[model samples]
Target chain A: MKATPARDQETVDKWEVQLRKGCLELAILAALWEGKLYGLEILRQLESDSDLIVSEGTVYPLLSRLKVLGLVKSEWVESEAGHPRKYYALTPAGKKRALEMAGIWTRFSSSMGKLLAPLGKGNK
Target chain B: MTMADDVQQRDAQQSMEAYLGRLRRRLRGMNDEDAREIVEELRSHIRDKAAASGQVTASGVDAALAALGSPEELASQYLTDDLLARAEVSRSPVRILESLFRWASLSVAGFLVLLGSMVGYFLGVVFILVAALKSFHPRTAGVWVLPNGADDFNISVRLGFGSAPLEGREVLGWWIMPIGLAAGCALVMLTTRFAIWCVRQYRKSRALPRG
Candidate 1:
């Protein structure tokens, strides 16, 4: 019996969602590792600083999740030109977790690179 | 700012408020503090973007909102993130209890809990209800003074159970049942309010953002 590989739009979309879901937490943590930024600022920074293109809506909730986990802390400071903005920064725990995640990500990506190298050369 | 610019800014501000209001309505079960934080952040972001693009106007506000995506989509994102985080955390009995309390009205959560093979929910419900009812049960400790030789009158405070006489002259401890009933009612009210409070606190504690 032969099994057919399903490459339907639904399947592709599912895969993409999973992929995005996995990386989003990492992207958010890394963005905060540099400095404090509010919800939208974090989204813009992620978009500009990395290959991660995220919608503004998703970022706020993710920030809430991170804060819940105690990996991030936020405070409101009155802006010079406008109202107070909730700026988020990494906690000590968050910094350690981010560092650990970065290390794991590095190894995983490097291993994936090696695994995909042969395919990359053959496609050329 | 000129009058025309003021009108444009006001129009833009109104649009932004409407957008945020829509978002707030979409985030129904979300904790109030978190919702407020989300709203304020988005507001500032919109204003900042508008300023960067030169003067706040309805068009600028529209563009900023378009970039953010729809309110429903945004709410679903928050919900997905919340569920994922919740799944990751160790489901201690307390957390599970809180979750059940939080989603008691939602059939989906009840279904999921049942599917998760946790018989503890039944135990939790039974425990909560029994405990609450027990509070209303009048019991007395120490001396319960009552009418002498009253065959119908008996008083015991053993283990939250109480006995009382119908009539007594020098009734020293005749007040146990009424006091117990009152205490019980209070306990029931407090228990319900505590359950609600626990759910809110759980949600609030899930993200305190240091502010």
Candidate 2:
């Protein structure tokens, strides 16, 4: 039926949202894993580097939560044009957590892939 | 600046103000420090976007706002992690009962330790009954009835039936009340420590990764 495609799309959209939510922190930590970036610059970097393009509102609140949990820290630094901007960088604990979580994700994803491989082959 | 440019800048500023106001209102439950930090970051983000686009106009402001998401969606993300964690813990009936037991024990233990007397024991028993009842029937708030004074503190309740009267009482002397209270205090402390350990183990199991 015509409703089937719409239902499928809705499910896919929900999955996409969940996937993004699950990995947003990982993406942010990965972005900051290299160096400190101002709030806007982090957004730009994420949009450029990956498929996980997110809104400014989304990133700021996440950053605030990370800061509250002591995983990230921010500082106001003068930009090239002389205005102050808040720059975020991972704390040592954040870096440790990121590595741990990434490792877990890698193993979990691999296991999922293996589990789904037979189904893919069957469809093929 | 030219009049047209001035108008454009005013439009941009007003849009930014409205966006920030929405954000502030949506984040009402958030603590002040975090709310202020988020608001400032958003403002700076808009300014940065505007500067990058080479002019501050209504369109540029709108673009920046769009990139940030609507205020409701944005605010919801801030609370999602905590809400998810709580939901995860509450998924199992075992966990819910565990939490209820923890609540009862901690309160009773606290009362026992703080007010080490017959009155404290009476109140603690009442509190535990109330908590257990509320857990089973969430809408009900259990009540306690006690006699007027500590000396007449008879831990008893009598309910009359059609043929026979049902009565419950702790038929112990007033002098023995203090000794019982002391023993209860010690038992509560020991049991609380053990309960906390068991709870931690349960939570650890719950938090374990699933295939």
Q: By TM-score, who's the top model here?
A: 1
Candidate 2 local accuracy as lDDT? 0.61
Compute each candidate's TM-score over C-alphas: 0.63, 0.59
| DockQ of every predicted complex | 0.26, 0.21
* Candidate 1 Cα lDDT to native: 0.64
| Top-scoring candidate (DockQ) | 1
Q: RMSD, model 2, all Cα superposed?
A: 12.4
**Per-residue accuracy of model 2 over B101-143 as CA lDDT, tens digit each:** 3233333442333233334344444444444444343322332
* Poorest stretch of ten by lDDT in candidate 1 chain B: B202-211
Clashes of 1: 4
**What C-alpha lDDT, on a 0 to 100 scale, does residue B37 get in candidate 1?**
80
lDDT of 1 by residue, B47-163 (tens): 877777656778989988987787765664565455445645754444544445334433353344433424433333433443344445433332244545745555432322445
All candidates: interface RMSD: 9.2, 9.2
Write out the backbone clash pairs for model 1: A68-B206, B136-B184, B145-B173, B153-B165
Candidate 1 segments whose C-alpha is farther than 4 A from its true place: A1-10, B1-3, B26-31, B79-211
lDDT for each residue of candidate 1 in A39-83, tens digit (9 for 90 to 100): 777877877887667656557777887987889999998997567
* Position B3, candidate 1: lDDT: 90
The CAPRI quality class of candidate 1 comes to acceptable
**Inter-residue clash pairs, candidate 2:** none
